[model samples]
Target: MSGENQAKGNAQSSKKANCCQLTVDEVGLLKLKLTILAVLCVILGAFLVAFQVLSFMRVENAETERMLIEQKNRNDDLTKENTKLKTGLQETERMLIEQKNRNDDLTNEITKLKNELQGGKCADGWQYFDGSCYHFSTDTKNWTESRDACVTMGGHLVIINSQQELDFLNARREMGDGRSQRDFHWIGLTDAEEEGEWRWVDNTPLTDPKLVQPKHTVLTFVSAQYNSHSTQFHWFWGINQPDNYKEWGPQDCAMIFAGKLYDETCRSLKRICETKSCMAGV
Candidate 1:
């Protein structure tokens, strides 16, 4: 009975030892589990911080790219405006150069004209008088033929404007033999368009009161009328002048005969008196 009681006490001691060992092993396992949890928390926090930094860098890069695009647009606009201004400036310069060239040409033409005027002389065979040139033909021709000849010589029938001019023409007339009819030269006056009205070769009306005559009135041969107030001599008609005499055909032309005006048939042969501007000879 003693032996059985001792064996029971030993069995109780072994069971107590086994239970203590099991408790120590469980505590060590709990400590290892806590350390693993702490390491996992640290890793998660580092990953979250890295993600935030990367997102911020991406946003900044996008903003920088947008700014560069806007700056490029502004540079392009400025370049277009500069090109337009250059084109306008070039066109203006070209127009100014053309205007300057035209002005130079006009100046040269004016200078040449002035030089010609200063010479104050007509061509050879042309007599210069009162800023005009005169040509006297030695050939005989009818009134119409005489006019044509004068035009061919670069002049028209003579128009006597003043007493001095008529006197100059009278001094140059041909004097025939005393027994024969007086030599006559064709003048610019004519009454062919209308029987009563008279005009000059230039289509100017006869306005000089001294030279006007009563229509169809026969006049006696007389000297020219003198104006004492102006100290000038005026034209007068000869005997039976401007009668429209049909015996020798219609007398539609005028002639300077012995320093007097006379109506004569256009078919009558006569000398020519032509006058022109001095510049015409030049």
Candidate 2:
């Protein structure tokens, strides 16, 4: 009976020891699970922080790119504007040069005209116009004698070359006031060679018949042969002039009286003599 009691006590003690060991194992497993959970939480927090930082970096890069694009656009605009300004400046300079050239040409033309006018001079006792010299006679003579006298003086009877010359002669005669009864003068024209055909002293043919028309139509007496004239040939005629009247016996010569011409006898009359410059001579 004592042996049985001892064995039962021993079994009870062994069972108690086994239960304490089980309790210790359960505590250690629980600690291990808690440690693993902590480690997973730390890893999740670190991942979240890294994601946020990466997002900020992306945003900064995008903004930098946008600024660079704007700067490039501004640079392009400035370049275009500079090119336009350069072109405008070039055009302005060209226009100024062209205007200066035109002014220079005008100045040269004016100087040339002045020289031409100043160079046209006549000898003493002779009036000058367009390079010709004219002399008025103080003595009277027949047509032949007058012509001879003009030749001796190195000139000839006045031959009308232009309407301006005619006007000048008429004005001169009016100013002379040296005639009585009639201001008749012997010119260098005659029809004595051919009866009806008139000739100048220089032997040029009298073309333009309208030159001797009536005084009313005389103003329209520009040459029919010439379309335009810088100089003109004309005639001044009296009333019923050059009639070839038998009453005025053998009137084949022409004479001027008071700027009007008439067929007359080669009697004594005042005359005009004309000479040309060496450069203007035939």
Candidate 3:
């Protein structure tokens, strides 16, 4: 009975040992499975993080592209404006140059006209219009002598038809010194030849335009009047009675210097010849 009991106990001990070994093996297998699961989870998480990083990088790249495009548009706008400004500046410079040229031309024209009217010794330059040289007097003589002198010179005395004609003669009075009948003056008109006929030495009839009262027919304050018969005088000069250089010539003849019809004088009056002239235009 003792042997049998020992055998039974041994057998039970063997069973227990086998069960423990199985448990340990099972536990180790479970631990290995758990470690593999943890590793898988870590790998999945890393993949998700990497995917998110890639997505953010893509978005950043898109935003960068947008900024670049905007910057490019702004640059293009500035370039266009700069071109427009350059074109405007060129146009203004051209206009300024054109105006300067026009001004130069006008200045030249004025200078030329002045030299033309300055009386000179061409003698032909002294020709009278309205048949008179009253604006300028060459010398003094009696009214009778003046008429005769004008006749001989081929021109009659100056007859003032209007105030304008008178003014033209008066403006040039700077040429002479003697103006008074104390400096006896010469005149084309007189009761002398035809009394009140008032005929020019040229024999042209004289009509009083302004009709200064008590006026005569061939009234020549200065040398030369539109004569019915003749029309020119040279070598003969007349004077204003008072030697007045104003437009109201009433000059027997007068002295004129600065401008046209520049008659310079004769202490001794003589008869000469001349043809009537036009004021620059007549």
Best by lDDT: 2
Write model 2 residue lDDT over 1-282, tens digit each, in one string.
Answer: 999999999999999999999999999998888888888788888888888888888898889889889998998998898899989989999998998999999999998875555355545666766667777776889888988888887889888766677777777766644654367778888888887677878887766553455323323344564333222434466656676665756677777776667778877888888888644532
The TM-score measured for candidate 1 stands at: 0.47
lDDT of candidate 3 over 1-282, digit per residue (tens): 999999999999999999999999999999999999999999999999999999999999999999999999999998998898889888988898898788888778776654454333114525343434333346546555666666565555665445555445444332345432222223333333443344445555655433222322333435454354233322122221223233543333333222212122323342223344434342
Q: What does the lDDT come to for candidate 2?
A: 0.74
RMSD of each: 18.7, 12.6, 13.0
Worst 10 residues of 3 by lDDT: 233-242
TM-score of each: 0.47, 0.47, 0.36
In model 3, what is the error at residue 9, expressed in angstroms? 5.0
Q: Rate the local accuracy (lDDT) of all candidates.
A: 0.71, 0.74, 0.50
lDDT of 1 at 51: 81
True-vs-predicted CA distance for residue 119, candidate 1, Å: 11
Error of 1 at 52 (Å): 99
